[model samples]
Target chain A: MNERQKSKLVVETCLLAGKIMIENGSEMVRVTDTIDRISHNAGATEARAYVTLTGIIMSATPDMGSQVTAIDKRTFDLEKVSTVNDYSRQFAAKKISLGEFYRCLKRMDKDVKPFPFWLQMIGAFMVSATLEIVFRSNYTDFWAAGFVGMIGWCIYCLTDHYTDIRFLNEFIAAICIGFMSILLIRAGIAKSADDLIIGGLMPLVPGVPITNAVRDTLSGNLVSGPSRGIEAIMSACALGFGVAMAIKILG
Target chain B: MVNVIIFSVCVYFATIGFGLLINLPRKALNMAGIVSLIGWLVFHTVNVHMGGYLSADILGTFTVGILSIFASRYKKMPVIIFNIPALVPLVPGGQAYQVMKCLAIGNYALAKSNLIQVIFIAGGIASGFLFAEFLNQLYLRFKTYIITKKATR
Candidate 1:
């Protein structure tokens, strides 16, 4: 490839890498740092990266000219985030050439399987059950939380797969959790419906978002920080709305 | 006490499940669990003695931040892998849930209080991390300065 072609490829590669990291919920500092490192090492004259929760804007200047790319896709899959992170580290260390980095990124985009749905469901179940212990609930509530959590996660997986409505999956999942926990209480299987519902809700909480928002704000990325804070609150509202609807109906 | 043990063990598995939910890297899973267990234990112990949830959050998050730095170096993984999951149980989910539940039920006063509590706890957690990071930076800079000075001598 000529210098122009090589620079264009590097710019595109940096943008692609940044998109993957941001979409996978990486923090702004890490995203910008990785993009900068990759582009500079790949022989760009200069590179700059700006990231937000919803999109990414990155530019690179090469001998021929300057190139800018913006991607507007947002999703959360931390496994992919970790993979890109490790890959960037390797590339920065000069262990991977430009062609190799491109191939690695393509392979990452195509490969890297998510955990099977059933395992995620089992994880949901264990989280809910163990949350009862964390909340200091009795064995009855413990068993109730386990069942409620498992069923709730299944509902979440199903809704998330079948629907594209924003926040609808969390809404429906919370409704299922609340409804099942109440039913367990009515059936005398759980002593405290509130405890059971809370435990079941553990898996659906927006803990990661909240933490990331705080970290972002602390790091001086003011715009991204508050936006992420609002995102976390919105998620909480969706879960709460679902639970509330279930309560209003079940009562 | 036995209760403390129960809390630690239960939170350990709960955190592991949480790590799995977010699909943390396989190598970081067990370490994340240990980090969670330690964070929650410190939070619990401090909250019990200090009678202040905010203080507990600060101490717990500070410990998690420090440990995450070391873990990142030792395990050669991103610190977020350990930090985010370890900080999960301390995110004040219950308060956030209460804020929504109260609002839905038309309990305005209760909802307002829960909102304030959530803000306070979140702020405390952020400050904890900031303080830890600041200290870490200071220590690194000082070490570098001393190393160069000694070499010159």
Candidate 2:
């Protein structure tokens, strides 16, 4: 309510946002969530404020994910970040219009740079595998099986490169790739179904789930975190099955 | 063993360099890499016994999952970038190539079995984590929902 309390809330919120933004690949969504939580402390409107913030980010840089890690993002000191978060939450709670939020996002993007790691890696890897299959001397169903993986690889790279690249991306890509691989292989394109399925899953390869699995266990989030662990396993199995059935069908 | 350490160090440096590029303090970046490397090693060591593509998938996923957590905790580095070196080795390149070869020659059963085997290998890695996560949560919730609820009430 008071300026002093608002100030403290702002500082903490900003610092938290900076940390999460720095660590995770997705910024816009995380920042929004941070603002929503911090707005409660600042006598600000969380919903209206977040919409404003989202608009600002979208306008500033169409690719908010890439911009999150840019050097410019470092300029968001605790106070400034805290104030912005509070302001949005307050505005949102009041059902206020967020013309300003949209403007800020637009401005913010000039300072944006999308993270390219996932993109380059996925693309490079996909290209590599696709090339290997496409170039196979004999034309066979094997390449067909691997084709879905190539697409999953592309989606994985696209999503991960500029977005949060979460656990879901890995699973979805793997499953899609797996599903497609079987279909392609069964058609007797001569490509081994399993090989193509596994190859297609390259993009979804585990990066954080393993770490989180242990860390969650370490920190004691067994229920919430481990469920994610199981989901990862099941999805991976689904991916395998998706392809296997196709193979069986052709047989 | 020696190669592992050397590679780990290189990954650490490259990861740090990326952190620096994004303006993270040296201490934070170094810490992220250290945590990630430990995870990578755990995966590599545990899954090394599996032959060929299977080994690569297990190690790669394990290495990456751990590295991302470190990055997430540090709050200053991009978790994805930190996972680069950890993932490179397990891209499924060689296995994909060979399987394609076997199939092209009309080895349906071999291709089918290999497909099942690699999928199982990758799935197995996820399953290991599932065990760790599930037991950990069950214990935590059991304490909270049962013991803690009684005490609090």
Candidate 3:
């Protein structure tokens, strides 16, 4: 490729790396660092990248112009982040050509595969049941928590698949958890609704966003820091509201 | 002692389950569990003897942060692959639930107190991670300085 085309490809590669990282729940500092590293390794002098929670803007020298990409969805998939980091390291060490690295990244992005649905449900079940025992120091509600948590997680995934409204899935899932835990308690399956509710909600909590917001803020990311913080708070409020609504209506 | 062991076991599995939920690399799953187990052990010990959940949380997350850094190096993966899942046990999910419960029952005073506690725990986790990162940076700089000095000599 000619000089202009090569530089444009480099910039495109950097933007793709940033988009994958951000969408997969990487911190702002890490996302920008990965973009800069990819461009720098690809022979882009004076390369700079500005990233926020919602978008990425990257530029090399003036002649190469700049590339901007908007991030639409965010989820938790550390495997992709780790894979991208590994590829960047390989590129830096001269183990892979820039074209090969770009092709691998593009292929990986297209072939994104999460764990099977049933397996993720089972994971939710395990987390809820065990976390209740860990936090409350009791196994009285173990099976109840597991069943309720699995159902809540299922509802969450289904709702997210059907609707594009932000936070609605979490709200509906929390309500399901609260109502199911209450019903289980009334049916004598669980002794305490508190344990079951907390456990069930574990799968839907905003743990990743909360952690990422704090990390971004501490790393001096002025834009993404507060934006992610607000995002976390909004989701938390939605979850809390759903639970509260369930309790006020039933309990 | 037996209670602590039980809590540790539960934490290990819980961390592993969360790791799976977030689709953490399979290679790092076991190490993430170990990291969270260590953090929970420290938190339990300090909370039982010292009677302060705030300090316990901060110390626990600090330990997790430091261990995750090492785990990432050993596994050749990003630190977050270990760090985020390992911090699962320390997150104040239970406390946040309490706040919602209190609000639902119309107990404003109790709800206010629980909300504050939740905020304090979150802040503690943030500070703990910050301290660990600061220490890591200092160590890296010191190592580079020693290497450069040796090369000059």
Candidate 4:
């Protein structure tokens, strides 16, 4: 393919990949790679496919995440561009993958100081701790912990959307979970307080992420998988320290 | 005073479990407080009317777990979310608070006792949870194996 054709393919692929990400909660890289593979399957050369993929990624732009869920389905299905490409364009316009968009965010890095992960952790902790405080019963502490967990998850989701890096978000989540557990223990800490503390930390547990990241890396996804594993490990360490400190200092 | 505290605490935890199970909104989740008291009443009646030192807690905790699991399934929510809610009533936070308070006041003996109690409680919670989860996994695996074997035969 010539330069012009390669550029067109890239733009088309990026838009299409973005659409798929929104509908399927898929990784942007994997989605794009699949499209690149398909193009190759369709007889495109490797070098041209690479350029096309790069172009598609560049064209995805910022603001795709917040916009993805907002656009109606009809806008994506134009008959002239073929249904798939039309849908892809719609995804591009709607901003399907926030994280991927942020991958391109450094191009215009000024004026966007994403909310610090620590503050979000504190806020999530507050919501969770309060619930445990009010409900001195069996379910009270657990509910509070879950609430806190969700808060951390939400913050991470937003951060992951913007930066495409999971490290800070996971750390923040771990801290929140740790704080929630300590709060639960300090508040009603009777014979069964373990249930509360342990339960509260469930959401922020790094087990799954750590396991998956390692598994992926071992299976040959160094770029994507190991990054996730490292993030999980960091988060787990943060959580352990946070709990120890809270218990020691507050006591 | 302890009775009042018990009633209120039970209600709150129950509310958390019920709200989670039902997939209610944020505002509705708080209602776990109001309804769980009724559950507490069941325990209270069994102990108070019957004059038993039954601790009502064991049954109550188990009830929360069973109900919370059911609630999550019904609500179409993740079990992880509901797991915390079910554990709300069993946190032993009060004991922990008392232990810390004793230590703060330099009552070392009482603090020591409370600390041991805290360990016991946490340990009990973990053991019970492990038992339940293990049993469930075993049962599921056995059932699946039986079904598969029968199908092959």
Judging by DockQ against the true structure, name the best candidate. 3
lDDT of each: 0.80, 0.44, 0.88, 0.44
* Clashes, model 2: 45
Cα lDDT tens digits, model 3, B1-153, are 887788888889888888878988888889999998998899988988998999999999999889988998898888877788777788888889889989899998999999999999999999999999999999999999999999999
After superposition, the stretches of candidate 3 with alpha carbons farther than 4 Å from their true spots are none
lDDT score of residue A19 within candidate 3: 91
| C-alpha positional error of residue A46 in candidate 4 after TM-score superposition, expressed in Å | 22
Query: Residue A4 of model 1: what lDDT?
Result: 67
Q: What is candidate 1's lDDT per residue for B1-153, written digit by digit as tens?
A: 887887788888888887778888788889988888888888999999878999999999999988888888888877788888888778776787677677767899999999999889988889889988898899999999999999999
Q: State residue A105's C-alpha deviation in candidate 2, in Å.
A: 9.6
CAPRI quality level assigned to candidate 4 from its DockQ score: incorrect
Of the two candidates 2 and 4, the one with more favorable lDDT, higher being better, is 2
Across B20-114, the per-residue lDDT of candidate 4 in tens digits comes to 32223343254334334443454455545665323444444444434544554454332223334344444454555456445545688997887
Cα shift from native, residue B152, model 3 (Å): 2.0
When only the first chain is scored, the TM-scores of the models are: 0.92, 0.42, 0.97, 0.46
lDDT of 2 at B88: 33
lDDT ranking, high to low: 3, 1, 2, 4
Give the Cα-based TM-score of candidate 3 against the true structure: 0.98
